[model samples]
Target: MRLTVNGSILLTELPLLERPAAVRAAGFDAIELWWPFASSTPDQADVDALVQALADAGVQLTGLNFNAGDMPGGDRGLVSWPERESDFLANLDVVTQIGERTGCRAFNALYGNRQPDADPVAQDSLGARNLAAAAAAVARIDGIVLVEPVSGMDAYPLKTAADTVAVIDRVASEHGATNLGLLLDVYHLAVNGDDVDAAIAAYRYRVAHVQIADAPGRDQPGTGDLPIERWLGDLASGGYAGWVGLEYKPAMPASQTDPFAWVPRERRTAH
Candidate 1:
């Protein structure tokens, strides 16, 4: 039942550079993030500053997203987009560097939305290629590549655990990629009408990382109708001994005190 704060989503009131320290101060020794840089290949100094910030905050970088490209603009990911294949490939170097520097092994590569103009079969083919490359790169550090079923965007194709697992299987079969795995995001799966219990039972061994938020609002645990604690217990029963990323919008804004009051303070840190 180890927990880690999602620095990218949790401490939105602080500047990006300052969120790591805030996560640490809030009592989490480990943090995960979206791609922290605006550019796929940011200046080397910016990369160093991020590494230094984590080191100074005494928070371990447990997970990170590869450049997903304009998340605010509705671009789910670059991996499945034919036009952005080069961008996705170029970003892998930076991902590998960050993994090497921070000892972060799990990397989530979002499967992009389906394109109206492109062939779905072709997009799937290209996604497998791109994912294979990412898998090979991260394997250098003994890391695994994560593909998640995302929700909230209709065009985003991967909306169920089955959808993501299909892609994972394709990448493994076609490319012999053993390092690719599933990122079980409970919020997305629940919101998309997938059976969470079935997914946990079926793909528990394939799960590389897990994230949680209450669905219907994507907010903190108690604010919505999800039995998050029970699901966590189920995951433990299913033999999942990995970091559970707290990735929801705080019901109370980060400007206020104690957004994490829902979690017992002693349970906030990884065991």
Candidate 2:
């Protein structure tokens, strides 16, 4: 399994370049970077430079994460609130460009807020409309546009595997795009009450990328009450082949612990 350090959730102290450097130093071959790309340095040149840094470090670009509109880390997706559609598209373009430049073929479009009073049918329609529009745009490019089932946010409060699959199917059908895929986040799955086994079996094909962190607190893998090894083995058995993103919070300092020791070091990909 390839592990992405989840540059934001784990490596907050380093620049985007150094995050991958740390990953390489820790013996990982591929790494994940987050949005707020400007945060690394408010210069596009710097973003490109970070791409080079990853290359120099021998760390492969696994994926690029887009920050949906929200209060820092809120679940405000593009489709639910039509007003921010412009901002949503704008951000997508920025990240899409970053992906192209950095050799990234996978991108995550997290599900956003759902209007409390909006009829379920109408909400689905609106979200589908927005996602299809965005997916079409992404399909024109070489990258894959993936949707994450987000919880605790108004937009994508999918607590069940069925609900999550419905969103994925609707987005794909509505967009008429086959590039749409799923980001199976184990943390969200546990909190949303999804059956890990069933979810693995059902979404094994569509699950383009996977992230693992403990639920309840979104901490490291062993820190939570999940059967991590079992589920991971099951997914692998289901013929799933993709990067296994290590998107968890570090219980200690980043310098202190090798967050990915749980991952077999020899199997880690180098590019």
Candidate number of the best TM-score: 1
Among all windows of ten consecutive residues in candidate 2, which has the lowest summed lDDT? 33-42
User: What is the Cα-based TM-score of model 1?
Assistant: 0.98
Residue 3 of model 2 has an lDDT of: 60
Q: List, residue by residue over 1-271, the lDDT tens digit for candidate 2.
A: 5566677676776766677787777777777855655331237776678777888888777777665654466644555655655666666666767776667888776656766666667766766776666666555567787777765554566666667668878776666656777888888888777787788887787788888888767877778799887888888888876788888877788679766777677766544
Candidate 2, superposed: residue stretches over 4 Å from native: 38-43, 71-73, 115-123
Q: Judged by lDDT against the true structure, how good is candidate 2?
A: 0.71
lDDT of 1 by residue, 1-271 (tens): 7888898888887888898898889888999999988888999999999999999999999999999989999999999999999999999999999999999999999989888899999999999999999999999999999999998899999988889999999998999998988999999999999999899889888888999999778988888888888888888998999999999986666566577888888998885
Q: What is the alpha-carbon lDDT for the whole of candidate 1? A: 0.91
lDDT of candidate 2 at residue 50, scale 0 to 100: 75
